[model samples]
Target: MVLQFTDVRNQSHIRCGLAPMEGVTCFATRLWFSLTSQPDFAMTPFLRVTKEYPWKRVSSMYAAEIFELKNAVSYKLIPQLMGTSPDDLERIATPLLSGAPFVDVNCGCPSPKVVGSRAGSGLLEDREVFAAFLEGLQQKLGHDKFSIKMRSGFLSESEFPALLDIASSIKMAQLTLHPRTRKDRYTGRANWDLIATASRECEFSVVGSGDIVDFNTLNTLKNFAPNVNTVIIGRGALRNPWIFEEIRSGKSVCISRNALLFSLATFALLHEFQAHNPLKLLELVKQGLFFTPCLTNENLWQALYSRLTTSFYGTEQPISHLCLDKPTFAKVKMIWHALRSGLGAQFMHPQLLRSRDFCEFEREFLNIAKDYNDLIPLKYHSEFDWIYSGEKRNEKQESE
Candidate 1:
């Protein structure tokens, strides 16, 4: 059965969404995952609904990425835009509302550059402006089925009840809380209790966001916050696309090294395509929540990073093949350093990649992109084909 956010105008209101990350989540990633992992919606990478780029690096955030998403793939596309002025929002909403089926306002990105320029999560500090931005969107879109992706609060967790109050007053279509204060950023654990309590106080459809990937985590948090009917995952989805299936089935599927590599390779191909060329993201991966120990070793990390930066999925086999020296944490960190430095401080800033200890190489796959014959390694794949199932892939097929 298809999961939905709400039944608005009889159109599918997307429930599962790819959270918009400036540098990390791009058009290619969305198109690839929608077909392979097939999440129900892809929000725009925190757009600045203004006249110009807030930061010099991500001019790609010039608008809602509406046309790009439409041209790339099909499912329900929700273009998220961020701006302080309703006029600026209206300028962006005018075209997107006419194009994309779903739309959202970003009140959750916790970057200083975003907050400094009064976009993304920064608007949280100004309730009146953010509210007006929503109200303007509500009037333009002609429905109450929009969403706001946000962190817990600006100053304190105690501010949640009032935040929910302010949200309820505006009569939002849905509220998605990332559950971490901007100050905590992505470091601290997300608070499900706050979401549960907010759901208790409000009648609006509430979706919980945070570190939700594994079925157990989803089950635990869902049970604890029974009021939250839907969960939005960002980093978790990168690790396991079948997470939705796991949640629906309530059973754990044994994940393999090959499977993880396949997912990463596909994502890398799409990432490179979207950016026109893969910008090395060694920095982002180090800071990326997507990397885990089992899925890779050292050589494997370098292989995929090379593929992404250079457009190689390493091996096109239906199943993955790992090496003894594959993606170790070091290789993964190396990839992060290469990409993060070039992408600049849009969202996944290089500054965030630093940690106290150096990560070691974990998996084994060599950087074949250095040699043309290296493509020979990806000759076979296992039974794990598409990460996601059904219509989304059909849509990708039809479009192609």
Candidate 2:
């Protein structure tokens, strides 16, 4: 049941976890995921530390946020920090650990801003700095409470052996490897062969991450790489929140159209509570819908789109109208403000916009989802559109 990859290697049960995502995984997000499908562990988005800021106040604020909201969910929550300096690590570790039981150092983030700062994947490019940082953590926090989350390498597979060599000597609690170079940046295949090799060579417990969406894929990883004990899911979990529970149950995962719709509604409701401004909430809703699988079903997609627009605009207006006409940020903000002040209230579902308790909301939605699953045809009837297509979508559309 424990989330520690090393500790759970011999355990009879498997450990599934939610990976950290900036802007996407927040307090409300963690709660929604836990309620829908409990991942054994969850991590806060990587908190950036620099020579100027060094994450002093921001780290404490993050700690407080995690500590305050974690009680509402079941999973073990860990705070993740990103930095190149050992001093930054030494400074943030204690305050962060004060709020959560464990702190995960983020050495795997591939964002250009992070890499440009000589942190995240950039750390992989500097062996001496990375070693000093790890040694600093060991000296300050001890290996029992702190862990590292890293990629296979910075630019190539060459960095993996060197990283593992340094990592094996260090006494980290656990290590989660994403098995992709910084150059990969979520593009080609995940290189599970590298994962298997790392699992065999590394002395510490290693968790495999990248492209794990369902139980079948999880099983594939387990069978292919017996050494990897746990798996961390990122974008896959966001697309289908129920995946973790389905994997845990060892059942064939089937996400009904209604299920996807209900999850979207739940996300909007949850996000409303945590977001500071209406625009931020709208952005999150747009992002969530963009990632969700319901776009594959027209009925469900229309229902969600209607509900979402109505929730924001307080009317039955088409989203395309706004996207095509009122595309400016200021216009959208004005529309949101107008709706909040006047007519928007009447159109939104009273139960959702005015939802009080997350648990109660989740239960009610679960029932609605069950009804949809029973009433609708199990196979999605809609034609797949070009909106949710991948990187090659533009080229395909042009050719057509």
Candidate 3:
């Protein structure tokens, strides 16, 4: 489907999307964002298709909820699949295509487990293999039914041209580039220059992702890559849920504490129903929270608490009124952490993270909410130190 967002400032239109973030951008999260903000489209987290899992099982596990809520959302949601096998791709996508506008192929995930299977960004290591894989998918599921999301290259940026050439050769619906090599991971800045190049070189619609923190950054990107008409926001949206609204209005939109509390309650309740397992919910929360660890200049958690107390409801309504259990409550806290991370602030009370039960959590949360004032300006751009630890990068040497 053709999607576009109108920039009120310039009276220009461009497609803005919510980037597919594993664990974080689940169906419920997407739905929350769709209702709260305006993104032209949202991509589901990559659903890995493999022989180990039956097509029915995979569909029921991941795509089922999306199918059930397909009509409820105002924006378009494209299911993204990850697999090297054409048959697997066809099997999984066939059922989804019945409801989804189109599917997206994930070629950009840099996780070791994903790349280890010669899926995700690993496909970029071999041009012939990548070409054959795309060809097989096209032959199996028609060229128009799927799109591709990928990084610039596997190990270095130099391979981007050849990879783009191979992807553009296939007649897919659209192409989204993160512009960072697998080696770079989420560290450093995304190479917008590559996005400009892809926009100039490709026949299909090109989307630019990464480092889109706020309205200023979005404007800079549009000016830098004028031909690139589509952009995706992942981390930026987490920091400021009103980002899409801000982009459309061409101004900084401040999120109120009550709004934040309402959002947290909505997400916690939705996630609880979706996860269906407390342990699994815990794991998802940890995975989805913050991508990097750094010190900040502001007390984000206290500010949120302060804002909540002074809102229309006043102190009479506790956050625990949402009736979330300990696990779901933990998920809410992690969501706050993610919001805090992007705002360039820190969670002041580390003890909150150690709360063992719902009673303890509610008590501590209420205490924090009692003291602060109503208005705390949520800032998007702040000092962030990107740490490049954990994930093992591809060892292949870059070619000259």
Candidate 4:
């Protein structure tokens, strides 16, 4: 389905998409968000294409999840492929296109490994290859059945103009631009002006991404680039799961402590089932529930803490029981780190992070949450420093 959002002023509609995040936003995470706070569309993490495996084998891994969830959910899940060869991309994308509304080519991932292979943002480094790849894919799949997601440039902003020129000449369903160079990684603020430039220049729909952390930021982006109707949220969504709902409702939705707990529980359960590995649960906990400051309100935390330790309401086990593991404790510590950065909270709660066992971890977690209950919930702005920090320097060294 075409993603559409009503613009009350002009009686028009704009589309919304969930940004594809690597190591996060997997099937279970997407499914949970679809059920909880549905965005118009969500892009899957890039499916790496390689010659070692046949196209059919590579495509089969993602086909089941994409087909099963498309009809089951309200949002559309588009499969994104990352590779340098046009032939490899076309072969893999053929099966996915049949099940998905559209397939997206990921030309924007800044991961060192992905770029080293001359895929992802590496495509931008060579203008001819980038143009030919999109042109060839368009010829095979047709313009309306597939799309492109990309960054402005590879090493510098100077490369953006030529890259945009090449991309705009091609016909596609939509083009999502993150407006940052591969070198920038996730350090500086996203350049919205470039998005406006793209909207003005491209014939197709343009989806703006990056730094969209709240309802206000969403509004600011729209105001900045009025023609760029579609937008995507990535790290921002992790900071506040209810962001999509908040944007749709046009108000700040205060997440209740119980709601927060339930969300964590639901995400954990879904992730466990999807991955089929209990240890894999730890990854989601660290990445998924970074919105810890949501429970800072005093009264909410008090009531929530009581129910959590004593007997969680409407759950078979207490919150402590669910969290009596290294994975859960790591998640708590990650949240604390988010809180420290977002709110400038001085207390790191070192004891909580230093907890030796699950029992101590759980106890320390509760104590820390209780101690910080008096703080007010502040707007979270994710710099995404953890993923991309010092990446450019390392990449430069690697290249040398």
User: Which candidate number maximizes TM-score?
Assistant: 3
Candidate with the larger lDDT of 2 and 3? 3
Best-fitting candidate, measured by lDDT?
A: 3
lDDT of 3 by residue, 1-400 (tens): 4445443533236667789988778766775675456577788899888976664746343553346544444567778999989998888889888887569999999999999999999999999999999999889989678888999999999899899899888888888999899988887678999999888988878889998877788989998899988889988887777677667766666544445555555566556555565343333333432111111112443343334333323453455554556766776776665565543333345665677644465566556555445544455744432312222343222211
After superposition, the stretches of candidate 2 with alpha carbons farther than 4 Å from their true spots are 1-12, 54-56, 59-66, 255-259, 276-400
Cα lDDT of model 2 by residue, 1-400, tens digit: 1245332322325678889988656655765676566677778888776677764466223443355433434567778888776676668777766766567889888889888988888889888888887888788887656788998899997888898888878887778889889987876557788778877877777888986756777777887689876778886675456667667666534544444445444455445534434444434433544333342244655666566556555675442243212122222222222222111222223443333333344444454445453433221111122212233556545756
Give candidate 1's error at residue 188 in angstroms. Answer: 2.1
lDDT of 4: 0.66
Of candidate 3, the 10-residue stretch with the lowest lDDT total is 289-298
| Candidate 3 residue spans exceeding 4 A from truth | 1-12, 57-61, 64-68, 276-318, 321-323, 342-351, 356-372, 385-400
Point out where model 1 deviates above 4 Å: 1-15, 53-74, 139-145, 255-262, 275-363, 366-400
**Per-candidate TM-score against the hidden true structure:** 0.62, 0.68, 0.80, 0.77
Better of 2 and 4 by TM-score: 4
Tens-place lDDT per residue, model 4, 1-400, is 2345443422124566678988666766775565446677777888888775454655332434466333445566678888777678778878777777678889999889999998899899999989998888888877677788999999998999999999999878888999999998887679999999999998888999988877778778888899977888887776666667667766655543344545555555554444344234233223433223222233443443444334323455554566434554454445444433433243344675576544465565455556454332435543333433344655545544
lDDT per residue, candidate 1, 46-98, as tens digits?
67766664323334333323553244333456667777676666665666656
